[model samples]
Target: MLGAELREARRRAGMKVGALLEVLGFSARWLSKLESGHRQTDARNVARLLGAYHVDSETFKRVMDLCRDVDGGYLIQGHGVGGADEVSAVRRHEAAARQLFSYEAVGVPALVQSEDYMRELFGRSVHLSADEVERCVAARKARQKVLNVGVPVKRTFVVRELTLRHLSGDREVAWGQLMHLFWLGNTRKVDVRVVGQDASFGYWDLYSFTLMRSPQFRPVVHIGATPYSLLFDEPRDTGFYEESARLLLANAMGVEESRAFIAHLAEHVGESVSA
Candidate 1:
């Protein structure tokens, strides 16, 4: 937890290791060791770090607590959270995060599916073997564990009409995914919206993005990709994405509208008939 929060805070503040050490009057090696989890955090160092980051008292206290928890191995720090490791980490973070937001500017279905669904779509040309597809599905399934965990995360989702229209699957698979979204939107697990095709300029023009917030860190956006995803820790960068996300929500269809849209699409695959 300490390592994650520190990395995010530093990135958000746009402070590199050397620069951060200069501001805190600490050695570069010390900060490096701390972040690497090779050295236990001390109060004096924690105070220096909090002051260097200009965090207020309340935020600083939370940061300190996270650090302590990380050092004691109580927080179950997750490593390599992108690509193949994303499945478990996504679940853990979603379950642990206080707030979870997603911007489905594009490729939204990729983030919400089982391996079999993907293989049925991309396997013929992409050549993903059964084992690889299973691995990917396992990871995706792990992420859904967040829905049943204690103190479930508050989830908000903004999707574009293009995402639904450009879905990569057969009629049934596409319909199933849309139905899943429809169900989630109606349930308490998420707040869902769809950006209309005719809407004016908005935040979701950047393809796709996701945001995760916790008590220890302000917020971080993860940019998704076909090959992998990257984390945006800089506050300035994240702030821009946040503004775009807000605009997306503003220009999107309300929950009821999105639900209706999903139902209409699901009917094509005969999913609504059973629903």
Candidate 2:
């Protein structure tokens, strides 16, 4: 996490790694190792780099905090989250994640949600002001950049059948969402599944969670929380979400079956939409 942050900060500052090596009197391999997470970095090194980068206070604090994390904690606890602020943190991980797994029991995952469906979903939330809702939707759209075909991120999305069946209790909206999900399932590097009666998911109540893994940073588990969500980078916390993700996969319909099922559901419900 520290290494990744350093690289991001350097790029933001438009500083070439070669230039930094000469100024910092560090070898190329050593700087590469530090920025690649191959070797843990110290505060002194980080301070010097940030000083050269001329980073702002927030980036300075964030980077220095990551430096102090001898235990290598990258947890972002957003107790007082603004609409876009917390999502930006998660989006940073999503932007760099090599792989992503999202399980949504209540509604569609943000990464794959259609624009209309997302706006409608957010419209129902009383807690979010209009501007806040707009910012949240915009942030999700930004994060969805990872879904671009050229991006290397592989994504898996598992959603509940019931949630698809009656989303916002609007057949047209639900049909569009189902069609979108089915289309994404057939796309490259994307897998969409539906949790149906194929297995015992009756007791499942978890709303939404996503796990992101990157070779350059520790894995993170994001759980839904008030105002926003909390990110856990510890092995113990990530391990539990990993297990839950496995269970979700075990309970969800096969990719082909889910695709076919969603297609059928969309055709059945899209009559009015098409009409």
Candidate 3:
């Protein structure tokens, strides 16, 4: 998380990594490893870098706090519960992002999931009580607020067609979520597409990931793991996810076709429930 902030500070300072290295008199390889979280920098080095970048005191404190939280580790992992440091880190990135790209294979993307769908999702957690489920749902809704802020988040989503077919046991919930996706797709803020089962990238069904981009920071990718979500800011990791998104988009249905497809599915689900 500190590395992500450092990269953001460098970008905000209008200094490329190479240029920053020249200014700091550090080797490119050293800076590279530091920024990618492969090598930990001492507090003195961090102070020097912050001074070089002219970062504000408040931001400096926040970055330092994050550094301590991670124990100099690069990855932040936490359960989906609210108020955890990992959750806070993810929220910070989400709030900062100007653009969000997401791919989901088995479930709906959180940004557009309906309240009913979300509630059902959280309710399924064996360990969560009714109140805990509500809290988690509330936290998720708060995350979606980024989409509606003054300058709304620009979003692109690629979902597997199978995701449309698999209902979370409630036809109304499934219909509501699909209609929500369809509605959002028609809006200017989001572009939603679906990849058919026969698409070239069928293997993408194995995982779900999100990439968030902001003018102030380097792109960050979040991969959902079993017990925790893994956050990656390293160029190699982010690049791999970016390329994966590109490949998925290449084979996904076009915006209009995807909207039509979602509408068709929602209608089918509605009819099924009526029948």
Candidate 4:
């Protein structure tokens, strides 16, 4: 990100890379590698580039802040995009992002999942012990408190109609989870949308994804919900997922309709909430 900014700063100044490299006393290959993100860079190099670009103090400070902010929070978005940035732990995201847009191709988004759903879902995982399941459920509930009123982080969740009917073996568990979604969907902090089965969205083929936007750092996209998920931070890639989220919102049912959809499905799928 530092390198991309530097390269852009130079171009915005109408300075050629060859000329800037000469001023910096560097080789073309070296500068090229840095701008392309193939090589790592440090504060000293960033300072020199910003100075040469003669960027305004605010731009300079913002870019520098991005470098510092990203130092410890992220991992390289590798070829396969695994490792959790925020999707893995729902709480970390409220601090990291100003807004979150999530799409799940199948089951409920993790943030809104009910305790019973989590227990049943986690119990299916052989890798997690019984103790691990309890710990995770407790932590998830605590983290989800941030989803309530007055939190600054904006949240949007788009899911398939299939998720409404999606059943766990336990009717009680499924009922609890869908009711939780109904309640959560009505929250001021959350905007929920459901894509009807009849709707055709090309990206529907995708398993699941989350896009995060923050004033402090670049946008990020976490693809898939499983342990093996991909995180994309590069502007080009994150931009694509961001656009995908927009399209999803355009096609999915409106917020009120979505709440009704989930409510109707929940009413039909299992015993009533009163039961």
Candidate 5:
């Protein structure tokens, strides 16, 4: 956790690893190992890094505390989610967030995915067993409840048009997921948009990210890629993602247009199955 925090701080500070090494008089490999959590740094070194990043005192203390906890072999227990460390962290952030903004290059957002869609996704994981996949799907379903609890979380999703057209093996599952997106998009606190494949402003590469913000803490950005995931809380890092989201939204269709697009896809899928 401390390593991840440090990495985010460096990025937020707009300092490249090489540039940081030049300032700190450290080897590139050493910095790499430190950021990757392969090696540990003492408090004085941590303080110096934080100083370089211009982190506020309170945030500095919080990060130092996390470093201490990790050094003392502390472990965070998941809420029966059975996910990796990154997944657990993302869930915790989600629970705390009053607002969430997410972008997906392909497939549906996890929060709105149908059970069958989730099952299909989990099933594709080569290492997971049937039982493990079932457990994960159940856990995801439980996590979705946060959207409807007390005061619903305000969410904005920007998904690519290609994602809407992609179908899972089960046509019913794909159709159901699209309908679920449609319902959620029409909800008072939820906004869903879609970026067309031909959008000139869209990124050339596929990327998925989520930004979560809460009243109690700084905003966090979560990037989930296969085999690796990252959670960033640094202001600069989170701000960068927020900017990226803004760009994506600028190119994306409006909520109503996105809804219409999803409905059309679902209708097409339903008709094809009927045929």
Candidate 6:
């Protein structure tokens, strides 16, 4: 508990190995092992490390509690095809999550990509080089494998009408993606919703967003815009985000109605309909 906090605090304070060792009265290698979690720490050593890092008693106790809780909170982060750093962080979180929720407006959640759809979309994008686009699409498809048949994770997706109309590549690709959503709606593992544009709710207009729910780390919020991807953890700020999410679900079309909407869209795009 103390060791992890101590290591991060030392790094933040810009303390070198020799300086940290001299200040803590421990050998450099010993401190390194402790910091790395290779050695079990006792209460006395925990107190010493806390003192070395100048961590207040209340904060130190909070850190200790966090270390002890195996199932703490969710780890949320920003992610997408255009947001690589955000994508990588989300990939890690998705692998660890037991349940996932997303709210989207513009682009599709890369977490549910089909290889064909990705290729088609990327093929049409001028912003990305062929190689870069291929890698991005492939990574997204790989991430989607977690939602494949027999996978235990539960996924819920909420999308608005504007996002549904925003096509990538061509009408064919857009229709295929819509069909895929319909199929997923029928599946037992997914809960799909479509929020109508006219369905008024007391929530801010967001570009797109994702929320990962787990019984383990603090909830993570990730947002992206062009070249910037931001991660947020302040609960007060996220309070509205959560509230908006609930309102979206409240105002969104139910599973059956959403499936019907997808079916209607597929027919509009001239696709052979199963949904």
Question: Distance from true position, residue 27, model 1, in Å?
Answer: 17
Q: Candidate 5, after superposition: displacement of residue 6 in Å?
A: 19
lDDT of 5 by residue, 157-274 (tens): 8888887788565788888888888888776578988898888754422568888877545667777655545665656556778788878888888888888999999899888778
- Judge candidate 4 against the unseen true structure and give its global Cα lDDT, from 0 to 1: 0.70
lDDT (C-alpha) at residue 41 in model 2: 63
The digit string of per-residue lDDT tens for model 3 on 111-157 reads 77878998998788888899888898888888777677777677898
Candidate of highest lDDT: 3
Candidates in order have lDDT scores of: 0.63, 0.77, 0.78, 0.70, 0.74, 0.65
Candidate 4's TM-score reads 0.66
Order of the predicted models by TM-score, top scorer first: 2, 3, 5, 4, 1, 6
Off by over 4 Å in 4: 1-40, 43-91, 224-229, 270-275
lDDT of 2 by residue, 120-172 (tens): 87777888789877876776676677788476877899988888787774777
Q: In lDDT terms, how accurate is model 5?
A: 0.74
Query: TM-score for model 3?
Result: 0.77
Off by over 4 Å in 2: 11-45, 56-58, 61-74, 77-86, 202-207, 272-275
Q: Give the lDDT ranking, best first.
A: 3, 2, 5, 4, 6, 1
Task: Give stretches of model 1 more than 4 Å off.
Answer: 5-92, 109-111, 114-116, 121-127, 202-204, 226-228, 271-275
lDDT of 4 by residue, 67-87 (tens): 664443343322211113233
Model 3: weakest 10-residue lDDT segment is 77-86
